[model samples]
Target: MRILYFAWLRERIGISSEEVETAAPTPAALVEELRAREPRYAAAFADTKAVRVAVDQEMRGWDADLAGAREVAFFPPMTGG
Candidate 1:
């Protein structure tokens, strides 16, 4: 799956996006997989509460299923002034 990072997530992870190969069933599981990969990933996902997820461009919960999905994006929650 293609994983995308936005805002500070991109800054912390040092990349905008990347293709990841994983058997993770949910976004939460994917996060665990990434967090275990390296320090950068761990730091980037250290506070999941500050993050939001989108699966295939649709906003979803951390437990959202990833079956047959092509994209998963992580970003800070949006704010408007």
Candidate 2:
């Protein structure tokens, strides 16, 4: 699956996006796999509540299923003026 990071998430992870191979069933599970890879990934996913997720470009929760999904994106919550 392709994972995308935005805003400070991109800066923290040091990449905008990357293709990941995992056996995760849910978004939260995927995050756990990523957080185990390195300290950078750990830091990037440290706070789940502060982060927002999307499955195949549609916003969803961390518990969302990843089955047959092509893309997953992580970003901070948006604020409008």
Candidate 3:
């Protein structure tokens, strides 16, 4: 799976994206897997409430299924100025 991090998430994780091999069934599960990887990932995902997710470029909730997802993006909510 391809994971993309944006905004502060990328800054905290120290990477823009990565190709991961995971058997996670949901975005929430994927988060737990990533959080277990390292301190950076743990920190980045520490507060999921501040983040939003997208599966295959479509916005999705944390519990959303990831069965056929090829790409997942994590980013903070946008603000209109």
Candidate 4:
């Protein structure tokens, strides 16, 4: 799957995007896999409640299934002015 990071998450992870091969079933599972990869990923995903997820460009809950998903994006929660 292709993963994208935005805002502070990208800054912390030190990358805008990457392609990953995972057997994860859901967004939450994917997050756990990424978090175990390294310190950067661990730190970026430290507080999952503050993170937002999108699967194949559509916003979804952490439990969103990732089966056949081609892309996933992560970012901090947004606030409007």
Q: Report lDDT (CA) for all predictions.
A: 0.98, 0.94, 0.97, 0.96
Ranking by TM-score: 1, 3, 4, 2
TM-score of each: 0.99, 0.97, 0.98, 0.97
Over 4 Å off, model 3: none
lDDT string for model 2 (1-60, tens) is 999999999999999999999889999999999999999999999998999999999999
User: Model 3 residue 73 lDDT?
Assistant: 100
Better of 1 and 3 by lDDT: 1
The TM-score that candidate 4 achieves is 0.97
> Which parts of model 2 are misplaced by more than 4 Å?
none
Judge candidate 4 at residue 63 and give its lDDT: 94
Q: What is the clash tally of candidate 3?
A: 0
Best by lDDT: 1
Per-residue alpha-carbon lDDT of model 1 for 1-81, expressed as tens digits? 999999999999999999999999999999999999999999999999999999999999999999999999999999999
Counting only residues 3 or more apart in sequence or on different chains, how many pairs clash (N, Cα, C under 3 Å) in candidate 1? Answer: 0
Show the colliding residue pairs in model 4: none
